[model samples]
Target: MTTPPLSLRARRAIVMTAAVLCPLVAGAQTIAKPAIGPERPFTAPARVERTLSNGLRVVAVRYPTVPKVSVVVTMQSGLAVDPVEKAGLAQFVADAVQEGTASRDSRVIRREIFAMGASLTAFAGQDTSSFTMRGLADTLPAMMSLVADVVRNPTFPQQEVDLLKANTAQALQAQLASPQFVANRVYRQTLFGPHPYGRVGAAPETVANIDRASIVEYHKTYYRPNNAFVVVTGDVTPDAAFAAAEKAFGTWARGTVPPPPTAALPALTGRKLVFVQRPNSVQSSISVGNFTIRRSDPRWAVMNVANQIYGGAFDSRLVRNIREDKGYTYSPQSTFQAMGQAGLYRAVADVRNDVTGATLKEIYGEIDRFREGGPAEAELVNAKTYARGLFVIQNATQNGLSATLNTIYSFGLPNDYPETFQKNVSSLSAEAVKTAAQMLLGSQDSVIVVVGDYTKVKDQLVGFTNITFVDISGKPITPPQ
Candidate 1:
């Protein structure tokens, strides 16, 4: 017998169902898993490095993959150079540097940048302040000119300075309301003591005290051609790039910027617990860390691989144990931040308040296990593979290549760092990784910072020694008598 014709709605439903099922059926057919091939050796891009008569170092790479160029001008000055009384002066200067130049007002500068369909941004970190511009290759000259003008001649207009300070104050208020922010700020202060890195961010009062004079003086001192370098990448010949840079910045006069004084970093004697009370909070923000080696340390590669196996990725022991097995957190991860002087190794997690202490115990247990036994042979291989894959993937694009080059320059890495990195990571043994972990991740020297309701988690934390009560700002507070 012939079947009756289906109604329009029924036909539509059948069509949709088929659309979904077709992919499923097709996918069910056994597909060959692509074979993991041997990693191709990375070849560094040919670069032309030259110094202008004025002492500005310029590095240019001719990457013809895309019809664009990116220029990064990095100054050796950063937050670490901020004067003691004006703690956020460098950050304030970074903000004001983009406001206006002697030759152009803020509005006109922004208009010209947008006219070229380019982006310009300036930021200051612990070790460096940088201004970057990216645009079509045809506009490279114009973009470079704009960058030079901003970096060299920022007027630090008083009105703009006031506005920046007001905005920063408002933002600070918003950030202070977050438990995570409080935890991080307090953690840095506790870890570094009076070092500049310990400040982590600007205090509102510091921002308020910043003025145009301080910003301009800072610019004159640190933003000299001698103390800065320009990295250019993308569709430009080295000669042409060098010419553009010379025309735009060669006239900048050289000046001495005495390095900032370094404070003796406080030593971590034993495991310490710092509690910041956040009333009625459901989740606790926890940061456990200790000061580690600088970026230039030889053990960095080994430490990186070991960190990945320990807590760096989704499959890391911390995540696998705390999230997948115990459901304590969605993710728990660790990072090794290598700076110019000293760096830090941190393991961070946000978990339900009830599980705060348990999570910390598990984290400590995982570290102890890794220290005792190191990574298994299979785990070591996987970490090496992941590290190598990341290196390849990160430098595959023009922007990524530029960023990598910038990092190399910023950290004073060897000219052959990319090649060296690959060789080192590939040859790293399980024992080497374990040695790095044992040296850097010992619980005895780590500081643990927790931000949550102290009443809910205090009993759980009683096992930890040197427990201290502190406010969100890191000032010690007395417990209720």
Candidate 2:
């Protein structure tokens, strides 16, 4: 049997008692968070730089965090230098470099590296190619020698090239199935047009064009000592590191290298929208942004702070608006990428198909609002703290420090970039960040790309004009009615 309802007087008494206790209980559970202390001064580890007689620059940093070291050999030639007809040749060369050397095959090289508790990896980027190895400090010289051999003596075995091509074609097919990849590919192509930056990677068609001769020729043209540098970070002295570098790579001959291609970027105006139809997709992957400055631009500090305040951080305006407040999506973010030649500011999110248009509207609204009103003083302080802390955390490890040094040398940044980073970020005023936001965060001069099923998302996109439809391979196509 159920109890009868309480009288109004009894109910009022019970409610008053619960309300009074609620405050007391809540106060008991409310533990105050620790206040953030003033940031400690940070000084980047000292770097000792030397140029070999062969013109190879060696940078040595005494991190000494552990009994390990990170050695990276970086070539200034990367995707930006690829021949127009042969996009992705640089990455192809990087991939094949470790297959075999003059005296060691892939198996022997792997065995040696494994025995030394090391890992060697090679990759290419927009403006540089890198072969990096991390291992015990005792194996520093051996790591250097192995990487040097891979960089200088790869024969580009025909059999290995054939296998690589087959594997790449399969991989490209798999990548095409991913809407994120499709969206990024189309986004870059739409923003940069015919510029080399538009080319993502080796297409199957381009992979078919690669041969051993072309690989060898590309290597010979760009893999010269004059066009490369070495960064070593670990428990080692400068003199010892330099000696190891000389012993491993001294004989590498300097060669004449042509200037990198500098094709002009196509002028972009208005809000250009490009859609790649991924039929039956349940979600829309949207990427929108515009070109910004170069890597060496002095305004980098301000732009970075503005980016963090706007969307670069989890507690940013875009995330707070679209993901937290509106519940339209999850994991939305904005980023800034700068190369030696150019820079980009991008905002990306994956949202349900039903909210595609709403998400886009919210993203644009947040960006416009942030640009106009700027960040609050509290927002500015938090952003700076996050940025400075992230910088310190990134450089705290041997691998991170080595990569940071590579970015410095590869992009022609000042040698003292890390040293002055915290000060530069901390000294910026709210007005400076606002000015940067105004300069960089407008949607009028942006490119929008969405990868989803047109049938599912077309109605949601009615507000957007200048729409162009393309297939997964980026070929122009007519959408289904």
Candidate 3:
């Protein structure tokens, strides 16, 4: 009749968390020896950078740990550039780049990457468009050249564009029906409003509207060395990486300046709720919260501290209350996503459809409480220590460090960001955190979007809304008109 005891993993996690939080031996407050300390001392590998005649910045690092090379070609253009009529063109274009190139077809390119034990990739995202490759270092020259070709000469074959359109339409059909996908789709809608960021990646009807002509325009406008960068990291020296890159991308043409992001997003304020009704489902996925500060804000350290304590990690309040106390969900977490231009803050969780209302109620109660009360002293200290400690691994891993470096440089932050993080986080005061929480946490500006079984949870959902029922394609389904 009684519930069983907590599992060993959960019990050990609690104890380890406690030790990590307070390893001091009394008066001095010195940190204890690291529990799983690294086998060797940490040292930053040197990196080198260059600017091409055409204005592309190149950054390279030689890793030597594994021969696998990672070449990333990046552009400043991102989803912020999506023309209103073509919401997902950048993504499709990124995909098409590898589908075929000036010298070889998509099939040939795909075969080359696989034959050489490499992966070819491209990502057109919200703020940046990029092409990447991972392969043995000896094959890097060939891979880099292939990447340059894709960037320079994406033929955008008519048939391929049609294929992408059809594939994406099918994928969108499946994704729209997924609970978490639905939660994200509508959550963005409610949070960002008319902003391109708010647009669903694809609506069933909208996918068909995409065509090759629009794809070509988006590509020509965005992909050029003048607007991009080349970043290489992994098992080769900077000199080697540089030479390999130059031989590939050196002569790529410069491009005209991109027009500013299609439009700026407006601020979100006040409480809002969105509900999607799935006729039969066992559970619901929910997302709540709204935008926070940009990545480069002076308030980052304090905001980071506040978020870590609130829901940035498992030991965070959202987890403690929403799962451990209420037993409504498996887990709850929050993310403070700050990038070069802007940022967003949101918390998410999933619970049985039957408990959707109760789970949401508890989540809000915790968010508002933390905003008012601030994190406990123990919570604050643990979060600070955790934030500072993460830097070791952040710098230790080749890919991790490279990504960190790219973000730091891309955002125009000072070179010492990795070093500054720990000291800054540790120095934050409780009051500073409270101020940040007030700024970053829930305002009535809070928005909640839930996707779950309609028949099971609608009555409960009505308690919060002037309810709106939208279907899987993100379309409004009118009852048998």
Candidate number with greatest TM-score: 1
Residue range 1-481, candidate 2, lDDT tens digits: 9999999999999999999999999998887888988776667899999999999999999999999999999999998787766778898999998898989998888999999999988889988899999999988889889999999898888888899889989999999998888888788888888888887678767887878888999999999999999999999888889989999999999999998888888898999999888889999999989998888899988998999998899999989998999887888999898888888888999999999999999889988888888889999989999999998889889999898899889888887899899989989998899899987785788899999888997898888779999989998999656
lDDT of each: 0.87, 0.89, 0.77
lDDT of 1 by residue, 1-481 (tens): 9999999999999999999999999998878888989887677689889999989999999987789999999998788888767887877887798898889999999999989999988888888988889999999889999999998888888889889988998998899889878877888778888887776657876776678888888988998998999999999999989999999999999998898668888978989888887778899999998998888888888988888999997889998999999999887899888888888888999999899999999989998999999999989989998998888888877888999999888889888887677888989987788898897786778889998888877878878868888766567887522
Worst 10 residues of 1 by lDDT: 472-481
Clash pairs for candidate 3: 62-236, 63-234, 64-235, 78-127, 78-128, 79-126, 99-106, 270-444, 270-445, 271-444
Q: What TM value does model 1 have?
A: 0.95
Ordered from best to worst lDDT, the candidate numbers read 2, 1, 3
The list of candidate 2 runs beyond 4 A from truth reads: 1-30
Kindly report which residue stretches of model 3 are placed more than 4 angstroms away from their true locations once superposed. 1-43, 262-264, 458-467, 477-481
Per-residue alpha-carbon lDDT of model 3 for 183-207, expressed as tens digits? 8878777777777667645566666
Q: Provide the lDDT at 351 for model 1.
A: 97
**Top lDDT model:** 2
> Backbone clashes in each candidate structure, one number apiece?
0, 0, 10
Residue 67's lDDT within candidate 1 is: 92
